[model samples]
Target: MNTYRLQQLLYEETDIEKIQKKKHNFIIDLPKYSFNYQNGLLTLNDTSFFKKNEYLFINKHNRYAACPKHCYQFIELNYMFSGKCTEKINGEKIDLKKGDILFLNAGSKHAISSLGKNDILITFLIKEKNIKVDLLSQTKGFLNISMENITPFFTDIFRDKQYHVFRNNEPLSFEQTLNNIIYEYYFPQIYSAEIIKCNLLKFFLLTARRSEKSCPDSQLEPHNSILLSQITEEINKNFKSLTLAVIAQKLNYNKNYISNFIKNQTGKTFTELINIRRVAEANKLIKHTNYSIAQISELVGFSSKTYFYSEYKKHFDHLPSHDRQYSAAEFLKV
Candidate 1:
């Protein structure tokens, strides 16, 4: 990710909370942000990697804000290999210079201006996911993360002005880490992305294990995992009748026990878990189809209009009619 994109992700995530940076060698603070379209390059040519053509934005931009510039899509990390700018990350503003690396989470937006003409930057484009399995071996299933995850993890700390070094040739540990990552991961062609992927799994496993965002309870036991998978299948097949009691009857577990088990093992109630899928499908229909809110509501199994509105608002913080217009930038703020 370049400085431009880093500014964008920051501009987006600033809505929820300020993400800080972690400490490294030479410099104490590194400021970064995310971008809009930084990851499109992975396609166009390489057929061997990331098969899915769709890129998911971790950020949702502020289309209505009067901003100097905007990010499109992509997780970007901006290493101020050397430069200066008055930057905005998800609307949060900062002054940045040399010896700083700014992280931008996916889909976040930001703006930047006022810079040295000689400013040079290094970028890392990545995707973040809780690591699905182990890198070296799958002996123990643990939650891991991608570099895409770190760009957001250390965002706030990098913004600390006390850590910036005005000097051009810097002796910062972050620089070294970046150098090591680039040289070690990108240079050697033998299993390059795989090695980086593996190391990324390790790095996240070491630090993110304790993160509040990590869903520990969702890690299913072998038997229960299979059962839950089956339950998920049934829910999709029969969302209209996929109640806790009905699901338990078919699976041979008591209704109350099944409800408690689902929450304990998945950290989501039966209704919440099922609604996640339903809402996802509804969102797609709202964005891609010409169906009215009422039509879409009925299609998604909401028999009552008021209940559908309430549920939709609870999930997206916007009405169904409101989000049906993402294609309309001017309509977003309405």
Candidate 2:
């Protein structure tokens, strides 16, 4: 367990007595806020309780006598690593046990009973923009559904103005993923942001796959599965010469519809998706073959060498020359 690391990052001490002693001081100066119940729901009005960060914030839930009903403008994920706690979401009571995770979307207010001294909850507060920019960018080939379809599902889980309890039935994988995230956060190295983003995506994908069984009806019905499949196949096979108009004509669909379909289904514009696949192919050639950068660029569908370099740097954070040199050094060592 990396409890010590977590303690170092989040709290001043792990001892219950010390934590209890300092708890009052922490909340004493908090801004005044109130819970407004309307339409049979409680809404927390003050948004100043949480400090904003560009990426994410990880902390332990302070041990208080009782938590007032509240919600935030950002997403919150609660994980119970030890002991247990009871929370009231909407009107239903949820008993969260060890290894249980509760995902609270934005604007969903709830209150908790007093937490036990042994109860440990790790809270993750993330901005929605961070999720879209960092996590969603790398999820190109993983799921069959588009971002448009999945966006509402996440909003429903986290921010939909409804009462929902999204928990993980199999939490072993989730536990491991969380550990990795904590480790990366506390002891960041080169490319740490990218590593953390990848792990966060993994966590979400696992949760989505697990929840699919229980909420099968929630899955977005594919609007044009056959067309999407054919289009993707075409892109994979002939991305070197592919264009939106070309695909539209070939599939007997309008160019605008084809563009929108790709964006809706893959969460990427048509050009972005093509470049992602092209850069992936370019990476392989740079690593394995003796081809020059310009040759590899042309082979991977990039017409201009400068454009290829820009895209490659955007994706890998390094140039082809750097990767080729590193590969050469490794080969010599072998």
TM-scores for all candidates? Answer: 0.42, 0.51
Against the true structure, whose lDDT is highest?
Answer: 2
Enumerate clash totals for all models, in the order shown: 43, 2
Q: Where in model 2 is the C-alpha error above 4 Å? A: 1-4, 7-53, 139-152, 156-163, 166-168, 216-334
Q: Write the per-residue lDDT of candidate 1 for residues 131-163, one digit (tens) a residue.
A: 332232432345453343543254432332211
Candidate 1 has a TM-score of 0.42
Candidate 2 per-residue lDDT over residues 102-149, each given as its tens digit: 777776667766666677777777677766765556676675654444
Best by TM-score: 2
